[model samples]
Target: MIAFLKGRLVEKTPTDIIIECNGVGYQVHISLHSYSLIKDSESILVYTYLQIKEDAHTLYGFVEKLERELFKLLISVSGIGGNTARNMLSYVTPKDLMQAIASNDIKTIQSIKGIGLKTAQRVVIDLQEKVQKMYGLEDLSTSVYNTNAEEALSALEVLGFVRKATEKVVKKIVDQQPDATVEQIIKLALKSL
Candidate 1:
């Protein structure tokens, strides 16, 4: 039941961060969204969920309580696991996910590279009510779309979108179209890849 951690960040990468608290180092997996907000010499805090299995005791951290809650909700879905839960957070924020769920916007949810229509629908059906209660179903789409381009590019790499593939796609698309949306960038990226 580790609710949160406050510490000096000692290391940072796209997938994980190491925080040194009271002379102890805690390695925690993170989403790129959280990684962007973390910087050098700054104290940071993250809500955490610990999963203990026979072979592993893994700690997953989130920059926001909503993200942590969503992570819990994601993993609770049948056939979804921690990696997929984290992946969902990588591309979608708490607000956006909720809005999509509330509105039954399966297309938006399915647009993420790895998710399918059925999975998207299932996720929305399962979580819409809970999210509406929690956040009032505010419009999270624009914010999610804006922050997600950069974050999703990083996450794309994690999901096996090759670096060369991403670089070629993002650079060309962003260069030609400064105001391109995440979906547009991804579409162009598919062509590039």
Candidate 2:
């Protein structure tokens, strides 16, 4: 099994990138999030999974081993496949994905493209315990990074911020921020509270 390939990126398509390693150009299919991380970088290391069939072989690449493992886990469900799994990974960050699964937030998982009630239910049924164990989310995430806008807003309300103030603060921060981090959230919450 090829664990990963460290190579120079030679070409990138909408869905795949070619990495030149040891005088070989390896084509790797990547997710939108991975593509954002790659951004045409020459030197890149991609953890990989090679799928072979009677007619052809395909290689899928991930930014990290955990992502590769998550992809495989998604495909292992009875009705889920590689494409659906990749699509799920493309839009949602792994942390959010794990949080949703561990919290039994089926609506969040079902919102992903190509995932329906059946697939979402299967995901919750098949992998809920595993994700909870892996992420230590038995308490449903106390990690600093776990707070999204909605969660942070709720916390601020309990901390004496008015409902209107909380909503305004969350809205202002979320509107201007491209990325959500715990520090940023706390700072914003403190400002409002």
Candidate 3:
């Protein structure tokens, strides 16, 4: 396996890039996230996955090791091909993807282009446990009602507060008071946010 490539970037586009290492130019397919990360750099080290098929060998590159791991996990699903996995990574950040899988959020997975209902369900059913175990995510099925925090975060977002920032405040409030109602959570988060 070509674990990574450290080279000068010769050409780049939203979907792919060519990197020159030791006078050899290697064409690598990339997701938009990786492209955005490496776009401004002349030199870079990209973690890569080399996919070997009967007909062709393809190289997919990632800017982060986490992204590469996610790509490998996605492609492991029966119906998910490299292109579909790439599209998924392009459509959502690795963190969001992991959360979606961990939470059994099939709708979020299905929202990606080219992913259908059955495929999304399969992705969730097949990877949910793995993702939860690997990432140490709480199983939402048995976990406490997190709707309060979610609702508070949504309300804050509608009020022009950033979701990421609001999430922290709402989470703190919810942790302090798990039985807090959505209204109460929102009110408390409003003060902190």
Count of backbone clashes, every candidate in sequence? 0, 0, 0
Candidate 1 lDDT at 134 equals: 74
Cα lDDT of model 3 by residue, 44-104, tens digit: 8999999999999999999999999989999999989899999999999998899889877
TM, every model: 0.68, 0.70, 0.76
- Cα displacement (Å) at residue 144, model 2: 11
RMSD in angstroms, candidate 2?
A: 6.9
- Local accuracy of candidate 2 as per-residue lDDT tens digits, 1-193: 7889898989876578899999999998888777777766658888998877687787889987778888888888898766778788887877778778876778889999888899899998898888888657753444433357667777777777777767656655664673666457758669655
Question: Which pairs of residues clash in candidate 3, taking residues 3 or more apart in a chain or in different chains?
Answer: none
- Could you tell me which 10 consecutive residues in candidate 2 have the lowest summed lDDT? 138-147
Reference-based lDDT, each prediction:
0.76, 0.77, 0.86
Model 1 / residue 185 / CA error / Å: 30
Tens digits of per-residue lDDT, candidate 1, 1-193, equal 7889899988899889998889999999998777776676669898999978799988999888878888898887876788787877788776676667776678878987689988898888788777767765533323443364576587678768877668646755664676777777777777777
Q: Against the true structure, candidate 3 has what lDDT?
A: 0.86
Error of 3 at 33 (Å): 1.2
